[model samples]
Target: MTRIHCLVAAVLMSLSLNLQAEGADLYPLSSPAEQERFQALTEELRCPKCQNQNIADSDAPIAKDMREEVHRMLQQGASNEQVVDALVARFGEFVRYKPQLEPRTVLLWATPVIVVIVGLLVITLVVVRSRRNTETSSALTPEQRRRAEQILKDAEAP
Candidate 1:
């Protein structure tokens, strides 16, 4: 009886798991035009809750809602740029995964490249300074070198 109960429980758990794994019914791609527009818009929109995922790929409730909104706007004969503009006007530039190139976002886009260049310049300066120091030390006058050696020898004796 215990073994039969365990078997039944396992079967029920598997069935429930399968049911929960069913794919969601996203808006049907009714036409190629609709699909193209959906694809283009989704790629641009960010998932507000997910830092790295776009709305189209995100399964978050907000992402689904945003996708539905985009579809509705497209169906209403809105141009892609118009739809994007509306979203930007409502949610701000952060709604887009890649923000538009503008003076406001210049720092965000340029920071990595600027940092790389500055870092390279710093590294070059450090290497050159090190080489210069080594060369200067090697060229120390004989009297100075002898005095430096004697000072080291006196310190070591203690």
Candidate 2:
């Protein structure tokens, strides 16, 4: 049982190590512009499989395919926008690090700023309310203090 567990662990470690290996630049470019475009697109497009990583930096098979598609489209004289739109159509807006500001995606772009503003407002309100409560609670009239003490004494006696 231990030997089987050890073998499984070794295989998993080896697979994880392979995942980190850099994928070679296998797509040959005929022009410097194509090369630059390829580099930019790969860096700009996110890997569908690795949500956090751009296609250029990811070793996932889907990233490899996306890179190949971008190279092919650029070779055929597609504009950067054309290539990006094609990828977005296939993989959804999640493929772009910065999705365009369409009505559907405006919320996606605005959500972070909105969340931060809302959070700040909520925190400010909480801080103000707490300060007001403390200020109001801190000073009691002599009559109120005496009444509170009398109540406490009655409770203790019961």
Residue-level lDDT of model 1, residues 121-153, one tens digit each, is 999999999999999878879899999999999
What TM-score goes with each of the models?
A: 0.69, 0.66
Model 2: worst 10 consecutive residues (lDDT sum): 17-26
**Each model's RMSD to truth, in Å?**
5.1, 7.4
Residues 47-92 of candidate 2: C-alpha lDDT, one tens digit per residue: 9999699999898999989999999998898999999999999999
Candidate 2 matches the true fold with a TM-score of 0.66
What TM-score would candidate 1 get against the native?
A: 0.69
Q: After aligning candidate 2 to the native by TM-score, how far in Å is the CA of 125 from where it should be?
A: 2.1
lDDT of 2 at 92: 92
The residue ranges of model 2 lying beyond 4 angstroms of the native Cα positions read: 1-25, 144-158
Clashes of 2: 0
